[model samples]
Structures are given as C-alpha cells and as structure tokens.
Target: MYAATRIKNRQRVCRTLVAALLMSAGAGAASAQDQPTISMAINQSPWLDSFVAMVDQYEEETGNRVELDVTPFGGLLEKIRNSVRASQGSYDIVNVNSLWLSEIYSGGFLAPLGEIEANYQLPEGVLSYGNTTNWDASAATFSSDGALMGVPVNGNVQVLYYNTEIYEQFGLKPPKTWDDLFANAKAIQEGGEYYGFVPRAARDSIVYNFTPYLFSHDAAFFRITGPDQAEVTLNSPEGLKALETYVKIATEAGPPGPGNIAQGELIQLMATGKGAQAIAVIAAWGQLEDPNASRVVGKINAALLPAGPDGMIASSAGHWVAGIPKNVAPEKQKAALAFLDWFAQKERQVDYVRAGGVPVRGDITGADLGDEAAFRFIEAYSQNARHAVMGLPFASAAEASDAMALSFNRAVIGELTQVQALNQAAADLAGVLERAGFTVSKLPDL
Candidate 1:
C-alpha cells in the first residue's frame, strides 16, 4: 500500500511538472506536436521509484510528455504482445527482458537501434548482456553481425543475500563457496530460529534460479557442438550433478514446503526475518530496507554469489532493455531514442542508483557512493554482475525456460527425482531446439 501511494504521489508530481513545463514553453495543443509524447510499456519493478524520477526529469527538461504503461510482471509480455501486434499500438517504447529478447526479435515487433537512429552505437563501458542488443533476424539468434535491438536499462544480477545478525550470531562471514553456504545454511536451520535459506521455486522463478547452478558447475542446457548445433547436455553427468546439488539445497536446507516460493514471497520471508539467506536479485534489496515493509530493516546484507567446486562464480543476468516498437510513429521513435540517450549518461545513471535503480553501467556501480549511501546494495551487486551471464539465450528461449521451470519445480516438490527431472528437461529442450530450427540430435538418449 505504501508503495502504491508513493507511486501515485510521484505520478501527480510528474503531471504537475510536465504541465508547468508545457506552460513555460507556451505549449498549446498546436505546439504540443513539437514535443513528442513517447509512451513506454514496462513491467512494474522494485526500481519503479527510480524509473519514475528519471522519466519525470526527462519530461520536464525536454518538454516531451512520456506516458508509462506499467503492468504486473506476469502480464508484461501480454501487454507488449497486445501493443506490438496491433495496427497502431499505444506503446512507442517496449521494455525487453533478456529472456524475451528472442521472442520479440523473431516476431519483428521492435525496431533495431540502428534502424531507429542511423548512427546509433552502444555507449562506452556500458554492459550489454546475451547479445540482447544484437540479433540475427534470419537465424533468429543473437549475433554480433546482427542489428542493435535495444539498450540495456537494468543490470540485475543474482547476489548472495544474508541476515547480518544471523551470520554474526553463528560466527560466520559471508560465504565464498557453495560448500560454505550449505554448511552455514544447515547450521542456521538446525538452530531452529530461522529457515537456513529461502528459494524461488515459483514457476516464473525456477529457470533463472536453476541456471546459475548449471553455469557455476560448467554445465549448460546445451553446448554449441557445431555452427548451428544445440547438443542436449542438461542430462549429462555434470548437469546431473548440478541438479542434484540444487535439489538438496532447496529441499534439505530450505524452509518446509519450499516448492512454491515466488520472488515476492522470498523477499517477504527475508524481510520478516524468517529466512536467514538467499541468492536473490539485486533489485530486491530495495524493499528489504524499507522500514515499513521490512522487519529486518538493517539486518540484511549482500555478497557475491558463492563459487562452485571448480571455483567458477556464475550469476544470472536477466536485464531489462528498452526497444522502440516499429509500429510507432517516426517522431515517437526519435523521442524514445532521446530518452534512452538521456538515461545512459554516466551522471544520470548515478542519480538513478540513488533513486533505487540498479544501473547497467559498470563505472557507476563500481564507484564509491560514500558511507552516506546507507542501506543500499552496491558493492555485492557490483561483484556479482562482473560474473553474470545470460541464463538462456535462444530463439525459443521462452519455451526452453518454461521447460526448466516445470522440471525444476517437479524436483523441488518431490514429484520427480532430480535425475528424472533432468531427463525430462533434456528431452523437452531437444524438441524445443529442433522445432526452432537448431540441430539437436547429437546427444545420446539421456
């Protein structure tokens, strides 16, 4: 409720500011066309406050009206689908999650940055994930030879989050390895005060949560065996080992009934002090510090995710990028580009972090924001993002992710053994890849 109220207040303030700017600029309806009103279709996120602040500043300074069509996370794709597929949709700018990049790319819904602006180039030192901005349309895959579809706006990573007080109580420092984390989690769980860890097992969360495990272990959904080959490896020995460990972590060390926790539920559990640790998204750090929303206000802290036995530290990179829809007017596209350019400035990115957004720029995240930067997540996120990788980057990424979610959920809930789950997932992935025009027959039957 507080968040809702805050957003409402911000909207009111933004409208007032925009009205004042229009008045000062003598912007009658006749002059309004001079300042384009580009609209964005975005998912409501933990960094909404930051996003609104950024937009507010953009509108006031440029005299351009920007309307945000915010939707719930689950509804984001549907909203984008409705807008892009229409003869003339309402959204000029479409927020692209890396996981959905291929879907949007394959459908030809978004205009490449180069297409929108002939001279477009990624800003120096700006991190782009999974070839998100680059797309080979003919092959429906991310490639350096492809067009620039968008610019990354958020650099969200999975970082290790723990209760400082709990660690201090148990003489534990933040874990640097999976073994260390497992031991600490077991100790905390046995103490009977809190669940050692909370997991995100909700259907939407499983694929991302599981991918880091696979990556850290040097296992993958499939390795590129040839120029266009996707060999099923999720049921390989290494993959099996990773899945087994993940299941043990979730079922043996996590809370009772750990199979259904979603992103919000996991955050709430940690905030309420019911959970001692987790590998959670950097964006979620905001709510954990909100006095009214969290009981563990200052108790929680973040660290880089633990390394696997081989010492590889992999983290999930599911960033959000902004792409201009091809369906929008040319003026709107230019306006959208203007906003993207404004947001990408280094100074503006720092301001965004202050307003509660996790910026994609490395320089800003690595900078010292000072001791005055209280109750914020910066260092840990900075460390984690350095090792982050796009969990699943494929033309059929959505379907592939859904398969992982289903199998992981089954394993978590004890409905399927870890081995069976991996077997099913590997077979499902092969079919998904083959149907999407990739070679998938290399693997021996799992």
Candidate 2:
C-alpha cells in the first residue's frame, strides 16, 4: 500500500509541471499578438527563401505577423521607388541593392539607422565582412545627411568557377592571367569536348560581367576625382586592352550566339558540364553544388579572378542592404528595427549561412562552419571580396552601366572594333555625367 501511494504522488507532480509549461507558452503567445503586423518587400531569389524561413521563426518567437512581398529583381527597384514617392506605408521594411542606395537615400525614402544603432548598441563595423569597412568613405554611397541609411545583409563578389574533372582530364591548371585564360580556352575549345569558357553577354548584365576584366587592366568608365567630379576614362589604352580581351573570349571560344547569354544561362552552362569554365557572382557557388540541379556537383572549384597585365585581381562588389522605409508607421518602425537587431546577431547570421544565405558579419564568416567544402568556398569568396571595387555609386549609375553595356554588346557582335566601341561609350558616359551636373573632362587619344 505504501508503494502505490508513492507512485500516485509522482504522477501528480508530472501533471502539474506540464500544466505550468502550457500556461507559460499561452502567455507568450498572447503577448506576441499584441504587436502590429509588419510587411516586408524582398527579392524572390533563393537567398530570400532562406530568409523567409528565418522570418517565420522570428514571428513565432515574437508573436508579430510578417507579410512578405517577394518580387522579381528586375521590377523591385521601380516598385520600391514608387511606393516611397507616394508615401505608401505598404512595406514596413525594404531590401535595397547597394547599387540603388544612392538614389534611394537621396530621395528621402529610407529612415536613418542612427537611432537604431544606438538603441541596440551595435558595434562599429559590425555589418561588414572581409575588407569592407562599415563607415568607410565609400560607404557614403549608401548614406545621406551624415547618417547611415541601411544595414548590410549580403556580400557578393565575382569569382572564376572551373570544372576540376575537365581540367584533370586535359592535364591543365587554372589560368593565372588573362593571356593564360585565353590560351587555355582556345586549347579546350579546339579539343571538341566542351566549350572553353562562358559568360553573360546580355546588354543589361554585360557591364557587371565585364568589370573584372576592365578593372584588371586598370580601366574604368569614369574616375571619381572628387565628391562630385568624375572624368571619362573609357577610351584609355587600358580600356582598349580590356575590351579587346572581353571580345576575344566570347568570339573565339564562347558558345554559339554568345551575345544572348545572361547570368542564369551562363551558370546553367557550367553546372551541366557544357562549359569548362565561367566567371560569375559568388552566389552561383551554391547552385553549382546542388545535386538535384547540377550534373557537376562536387566537381567544381572556385578561385579568385585571373590577374591582368598589371598583375592585379579586381572584382565588382554587389551586396544587399536592408532598411526601414520612411513611410512606415512609427510603431511599425520600432517592430522592424527589433527584427533587424535579431537578424544581425552573430549567432543568427551563422544560422543564416546554414540556411543558404551568405553571412555579412566577419565573426560569422570566420566561424567554424561544420561543412569543410562550404567553408573553403566562403574563404575564397571573402578573399576575393578584399580586392573588390564598388561599381559606379552615383544616382545615374544605371544610365552609365547601360551605356557601357551597349558599347560592349556592339563590340561583342562584331559591329565595331574595341576602340570604336569604347570611344562611343565614353561619349555617352560623359553625357550622363553632364546631365547630372558634373563637369566631364576631355579624353586623350587612344
């Protein structure tokens, strides 16, 4: 009879503990529902899918509802611009590409992140990984009125991706310079096994893909001389060399109809083993490793872009920053800032990498990721980022990129020589700067 009584007493204690836990969870849920719902606008890329999954966790913990507007990248900027101009509080938080930061900030579309930084006690340089400093002078592109405008969330740079199996079969090594790249590409294409190299040539994307080549040769469309002054340099000797190399790669060894290839198509060509090599954004690394999508999964290696005549390796920087729109309601802004705080925490950033998004925090990037191969690629990407230069940062950067793209396209299609294409491009870029109220300097003869 004493043993039975002890058993009953134990059962009674377990039931009481369960009831208390349930009560606590219910209370937490009640508190979560008290806050207003937040709406966010983000790209519809795979990276954003991972981010949305994380947002789901945040919502469950805080009891705040979040509505996501996942839009295609092409139309996202115009959508945000219109909403901000109309002061429509449709989105409490928005994602801003580094390229568009100047236009967005200059238009008073984003709230200054200064108060949020102080409230959270965020450390200096917390948002930057690799060689990018949080408040460097270059960061002025994303700031306005002497205040930070956004928190960086993604870091990207261009890298060369090559098929290791193909290289080994051909008894070859990766190229170290543009000349080496051309020679290897020619030899591989002549072998008739695979196309030598592939890259995006679409007019809208050609400039981005061509930047590493241009920078390697120390060429630029415009050189910033001061805060508001820039000089046209697209017709320089370096510019001609870079353009000639770019055209030769596509004309001599690239796949048929190279003028139509875009970033996505270039990645697909490499992933499926059709192309032996490619130069693309670091984000493509994940796609190359996806077993379901890639035939060459685990058979590819990434490296820094090849050097130019100057023996310098340069890449274009492209990252995304998150900000609260000025049109957001006051209370909603607090909620959005709270979410940013949670998202930027180092531990959370590490988790984000595991979920397929790149981490922009140095601590997280340098952490011990359990996957060895992934860590190696991240290391390479971070190293390449160290040598990256930002694309044009002015409000008219889009127009300037368009000018360069058109010139590159014409040259790639044999419509004009490299010198002719670059000269015309320089003239167009000068027009863009002149309209933006900056004096354009005369170009020397090539």
Candidate 3:
C-alpha cells in the first residue's frame, strides 16, 4: 500500500516536470553552453574519500574547480528527484545505482554520455566490458540505441568468505559447487567452534542473498523488451525453485535467528572468526582484509560463489554509475568526460584499489591480483562478473526492494512458507508495475 502511494506521487512529479520542460525548452537551449558549475552525489565509502582527494588534485592542476558534495544514498536520490522537478539542475554529476538510469533519463533530466565518451578515450579496464558496440552483451548499466549512457566506477559482486585454517583442518578445498559448500560447511560445524555458514538473512539484505540464485536459474523480477518496457516474470517455476533453494540454505546452514542477521553484523561475524563461511558483497570483505581496520587480520579468505544446477552461480553488480545532468553546460559536460576518463585510468584505479575499491580491470587479476585470498576473490569476480544481474528500473525500486524484504523476513521467522512468501512478493511486484503503467513485455528475458 505504501508502495502504491509512492508510485502515484512519483508519476505526478514526472508529469509536472514534463509540462515544465515543454514550456522552458527555449530557455534550456540557451543555457546549454554556459559554464557548468557541477554538484555531485556519493554514498559514503573509502573510494569516495579517494575521489575527493583526486578531485582536489585535478583542480590544482587544471585551475578549474569541481565542487564535491556528499550525501547518504537515500538522501542523494530524494534531492536529485526534487531538484530535477524544480528544473534547478542542482547536480551536474551523480553516482547512482542502476535502477535510477531509465527514470532519470526519461524525465529529460540526464544527458547522454555518448558525446562525452566519444570525445575522450576511457581508461583501460575501466568498464571495458561496457564500452563495446553491442551494448546488450556489455556490462554497462544503461544503454539505448547503441549508445552507452553511464560509466561504471566500481566492481560489485557477491562472493564467499571462508576461513583457510578451517578448510585445511577439515582437508577440504574451496567449494566449487553449492553441494560442496553445504557439505564442507556442515562438516566444519562439527567442531562446534564455528558454524558452517553465515549469511545476511535480514530484511534489508534478503534480496541481495536471493536474487543472484534466481537469475542463475534464469529467472528475474521483470522481463524487458525495450527501454520503456518491463513485465512481471517472477511467477515461473524456475523462480520458485530458486527461492526454495535460498530458503533451504538459510534454514540448514545459516546461523540461528538468521533473519536477524543484518548485512553489517553478518560480515562482522565472519571477520571476527565466529563463522567459517559467509555469502556477502566483496566490499565488506575487503575492509576486513585491511590490517589497520580489521580485528581478524590474516585469517579470512574470500572465494567465488559456488555453482548451482544450471551452471556457476551468479551475483548482482552493485556499481556506482556516473551520468551527466542534462542541465549542465555542454562545455562543462565535455570537461566532465575528460575528468572521468582520467579518473578511470588504470594507474589511478590502482589508487582506488589501495583504498579498497574492487579490482575492475581484468589484467590486474592473477599475479597482479596480489595476495592469495585477494586473488581468489578476483578470480571468482572475473568468471562470474559477466553473469551479474543489472538492477531493474521500477518506478519505486526502494518500495519493491522493501516488499521483497518483508516477504523474506516473514519466511525467516517461520511465519510463511516459501511458496506463500514468494507468491505474496510476486503479487506485490505486479501491482507496482501496473500502478507505474510499466509493461513487463519491454524487459529482457531471464
């Protein structure tokens, strides 16, 4: 019900903005060449700190100022939406999740990045997969009519973190398949010193844990046939099976009170050596590997998520994508591209890696991947990265994500059966699509 209200409100905002754009087209045309004083949005992370430092260096070298503003992820999105509605162009560049791509662009609020991309050579290994001519096959977060509209600034994937000593003590190797993971984890728990697996089973992180498995089995939240297209596709047998598998793992191998395990707390359990294995995002593990910050130091090993019946397991790509605001001046947009190209440089990216950015470049893997566990992570990321799911552009992504959480939360507490939980979720998702006037026929088949 909350989701339905949010959808209605968003549509009204979009409608008002469209009418305003039509009335101000001429004024907008004239302001296109003005010097673009840019405002940018970022989620808090170590990489963001590095980004600010680099921006300072660039300003010093070029004598042109680029203002850097930081906001929580939620606050940033709200501000961007409100600013665009007012035709204020408060932000010149924004780092956002993939689902925001279509809505922002369709609202005539974001500028296409093709002109910027073509004007400068992008850094090597920085979203090279997304730069190809055939965009559907590329890893780009947003593409339309053969043009890439965003640049990937981070490498995001789910991976397994295990204790090396636990594996060796049990004479076990890193799990290459889901069954292997289950067996190894179960046996290791016999010592009673640690549990076999720890996962983020909480409401906030349930989708992150479940969606990849669904996609690996060739299922998805929506089917898309085009940019302005999408339809519900979660009711299929494959999707149900995937959800069943997710419930099985959590029920069998995950810690007690699993639904209470928030993402941060779950990772912290793994880092402190209370658990032998964890399924989580790469960034969290990377922080644990840092000696200065981590309490476990030199104990945990990160590896690939094991395969499912279909093939190797897949993960979602949660990247920070950069796009220009349509309101920004053209020359400034050009400069922003130049800055992005340089910022994405492999050498500069090394700085990002040192600051704990996931290695996005292929050549940097293997020997260049440094220490043993880090290599394990990079290897898994390289193999599974291509299969990672791109988030959908629902009118209310936050709402949909929340609904998914509620269903899983109920299942976690044994309040609902797997079938009941997913059934409720599917109905909620369908209602959201209908309310937004979005048809599932436009999305890609899972």
Candidate 4:
C-alpha cells in the first residue's frame, strides 16, 4: 500500500511539474507537430528520480523540454502495453524493467537506437546509451530483423541475507551449501522461539525466489539449444530436486501460515530479527541499512548465495532500459538519444547509486558503496550472475510465477508431496505454454 501510495503521489507531483513547464512555455493544445517536446513514463524508483534530475540538467543545456509521466509499478506495465499497441506514440522514451525487453522488442513497438547512438557523443566514462546487462552493453535485445529497443538504465542483483545475532547465538556459520542451509535452519528453528527461514511463497515472490534454486541445481526454464527447439524444462531430475529443496526449507523452517507471508512481511520479519536468513534482492538490504527502518542494523550480515550440487549460485537481475517508439520522427529520436547519453555519465550514475539504484557497470562493487553489508551484497550478487537467467514476457512471467506459488503453498501445507506438487505443476505449466503456442519437446523431460 505504501509503495502504491508513493507512486500515486509521485505521479501527481510529476503532472504538476509538467503542467507548470507547459504554462511557462506558453504552449497550448499539444503545440505544433514534432516541435521538440518529449514525453517519458517511468515507474516510481529512486534511480528514476535521479534520471529526472539529469533530464532537467540536459534541458537547461540544450533548451529541449521533456514531459514526464510517473506511475506505480503495478500500473506502469498495463499503461505501456495499451499505449504501445495503439502506436499512439504516448511516450517518446519509456523506462521499463529489463524482463520486459523481449516482449517489447518482439512486438515491434519500439524504435531502433543504433543510428542515434552513432550520432551522439556520450559523456566521458559512460557505456554507450541503450546498454543492458544481458549482453554486456554492446549487443541489443533485437535481432537484425527488429529495432534496438530499450536502453539499460540501472542494474540490480540478488543475494543471501542472514541475521548476524541469530547466527552468533546459535554458533552457526554462514551456510555455504544447501546441506548446510538445511542443517542450520533446522537447528535454529528447534528452539521454537522464531522461524529459521522464510521463502517468498505468495504470488510473484515464488518465481523470484525459486529461480535461483533451479539455476543452482543447473536447470533452466527453457532449453536454448536452438530457436526452433525451445521448450519447457521444469520437470527434469535436477529441477524436481530443486523444487524439493524449496519444499523442505519452506515447510520445515517457515511459519505455519506460510502462504500468507508477502515479500514485505518476509523482509520485515528478517529485519526485525525473526527470520534467520533469506535470499533477497540487493535493494532490500537498504531497509536494514537505514537506521530508522531496521532495529537490528548492526546485527545483519550478507553472504554469497549457497550452492547446490552444481556449485553455481543462481540470481536474477532487476534493471531499467529506455527505448524509442516505432515510426517516431528521426529528429525526436536523436533528441532522446542525446538525453540518454547525458543520463549515462559516470557522475550521473553515481547520483543514481546514491538514490538506491544498483550500478549496471561492473566497475562499481564493494568498493563503490563503502558499506560493509552493501559491499557483501555486491560481492555475492556479482559472483551469482554467472548463473543468472534471462527474463521472459511480463504477463507470461506473472502466469508462470503464480504456478510456482500455488505449488509451493500446497507443498508447505502438506496437501501434496514434493514430487507430487512439482509433477502437477509441470503438467499444468506445460498446458499453459502449449496454449501460448510454445513447443515442449526440446526441454528437459521431467
């Protein structure tokens, strides 16, 4: 509710600012065709706040104006989808989560940035504009057949967070392996005073939290063996074992009403020292880092994510990218690129970092943040990326994620055995994908 409210209030403020800008410029009724006014829509993120500040700086220098539209995270996707489908050009540049890049590019809704990048002289010490973590900033998400949509804005990582006081009191070392994690969780929960672990089991949290385990077990959502053979791969032995591990820790170490625990509550429980450990997004640690937000500030420590039999720590990347709209005027597109180039400067990136954005470039690490816990999170996240998975379409992702949540809830409640739950989940998921027109032959036959 707080995040939603913040998003609403932020939108109100942005609208007021844009209205004021329009009034000062003495323009009325959408002013003459392609007269240099640009519109941008972004979800409420601190990184975007910094980006807006950069936009202001760019405007002052170039005399180019930008009208920003801000919305809540929940509302942003729907808005983008509706607007892009109409080709109404509602947004000149849109800020979106990295996961949605494929869908946006594939839909042919976004404009190419290749020509624009070639024309602009980016600020010093910045990667070329439109760079995302998925391809090292050199490659674009689209094939030669499509436009280069979405410029990468911020980079976020996932890490394992633990309660320092709890570990110390129980004489438990940070878990290095899944076996150690299970043993430690059981030992810590034996006292029955508090829960030892909490896995995100509600809605989307399930997939965000579960993907790493699958990766650690050396499984993937689809076999990228070939474009023609991409298929579902969630039922293999390793995949089933990964799901089993989730059932073991969540059912055994979590609270009885496990399905009711939302991401915020889980984080709060960990921050208030109730949970012994959890795998959390890097930005989540900022809550513990804040003196007013965390009661146990110094009593928290971050560790690298644990390994499974494969010895690889799986993680997800949360990032934002800016892309142009299809059929947009070349001059307007050039202006967007100029603005983006300025926004990617090192100094501006530092500003974004200070405002809570994890840097996308590899140069910023533990040394960059200067906070021990934050540094630890960076170290863990950087190492874990070796096993990171790419994101799929937003709606498909939400559906796929919900399937895992339902299975997890059932397993945690003992309504189904782990294998039974995973098998059922695999079957249901295969049906869902088939309906969505995906093939199931090349993926692991779980």
Q: Give the number of the best model, judged by TM-score.
A: 1
- Measured on C-alpha atoms, candidate 3 has an lDDT of 0.62
Any runs in candidate 3 off by more than 4 Å, and if so which? 1-38, 60-64, 86-88, 116-124, 128-146, 225-229, 366-376, 440-446
- Clashing residue pairs in all predictions, respectively, total 0, 0, 10, 4
- What's each prediction's TM-score? 0.87, 0.83, 0.81, 0.79
- Tens digit of per-residue lDDT, candidate 4, span 64-178: 6777787778898887887777746677778777667656665667665665555332233332222332221122232323344545666655677888788888899988888
On the 0 to 100 scale, the lDDT of residue 14 in model 3 is 20
Q: What is the C-alpha local distance difference test score of each model? A: 0.77, 0.72, 0.62, 0.63
Model 1 backbone overlap count: 0
Query: Which candidate model has the greater TM-score, 3 or 4?
Result: 3
lDDT, candidate 2, equals 0.72
Task: Rate residue 144 of model 4 by lDDT.
Answer: 27
TM-score rank, highest first?
Answer: 1, 2, 3, 4
Q: lDDT, candidate 4, residue 229?
A: 28
Task: Encode model 2's per-residue lDDT on 1-446: one tens digit a residue.
Answer: 11212322433422111111121233223333446777777776757655765565556566666777767899999878877777566787788776776677666677766654453334343444222222224433432224656666676678888888988888888899999888888888999989999968889789888888888898777776766577898789898999899899988987988888998899999989989998888889889999989999889988878899989888887778777888877778767776666666655565567667776654544445765575557766766766777656567888888877887898898888888888888888898988877767948756
Candidate 2 wrong stretches, greater than 4 Å:
1-37, 61-65, 119-146, 362-367, 374-376
Which residue pairs show collisions in model 3?
223-443, 224-442, 224-443, 224-444, 225-442, 225-443, 226-442, 230-439, 230-440, 231-440
Best by lDDT: 1
Clash total of candidate 4: 4
TM-score of 2: 0.83
What does candidate 1 score on TM? 0.87
